[model samples]
Target: MIVLLGITLAVVILVVVTWMLLTRRLREKYAALWLVIALAVLVLGIFPQLLETLTGIFGVQVPANLLFSMAIVLLLGVSLHLSWELSQAEDEIRRAAEEVAILRAQVERIERAISSGKASGVEDADGVG
Candidate 1:
């Protein structure tokens, strides 16, 4: 019964992840990781012995502890990647904002110069004023 439930959940996750990838809601790189995880879950559900073998090889007392440790590690890696991406995006935004401010200042200066020129009638059609 538990195996059936796990298989069902794994299939649901697989379908959802595939849909997200197809809709461009998730990037291919991230989708690849999610697909791998879902497939791993499905395989483990189908063959419960694999986990037992792994636990035995690793000298783990319980399979659940090994699974939990792996999950925690994967989550930590994902969190770190997300943090780095966010930092890069923030830097890009800051640089863009600074460039915009500089451009705006230049525009304001040009406008002021144009207004002053018109007021002083310093620009003449004859090319001399």
Candidate 2:
């Protein structure tokens, strides 16, 4: 088991390093998060007892697969939250675009009125005595 952990840790380190190099992103940007995940997988893959210990914290007596399934559900919850925020932003953008279009049309109408009055040599009633 110890050997397996060492191997897994080495593999994870190598893969993370390779990814960071390929992406050209500062490792610090993602290093901490990936390190935690790699360490978790390495620990869990090699020491099943760790899962039992973790489950005990939540009063859970389920298999590791169930815990994995719960993680998937949590990811879906995050995705749903992001989707809701995007939907709200989209609605706000649409409303803003409509308002801008209306304002542009009003400005165009005013401009046309001014040009036509100039051509006809008529005083703007609102502006004259």
The C-alpha lDDT values of all candidates are 0.92, 0.73
TM-scores of all predicted structures: 0.88, 0.52
Rate residue 25 of model 1 by lDDT.
99
After superposition, which runs of candidate 2 have C-alpha atoms over 4 Å from their true positions?
A: 1-50, 57-63, 123-129
Report model 2's TM-score to 2 decimal places. Answer: 0.52
After superposition, the stretches of candidate 1 with alpha carbons farther than 4 Å from their true spots are 124-129
lDDT of 2 by residue, 64-119 (tens): 66668767976786678669978999999999999999999999999999889878
Tell me the lDDT of candidate 1.
0.92
RMSD, one per candidate, in order: 2.5, 6.9
lDDT of 2 at 125: 69
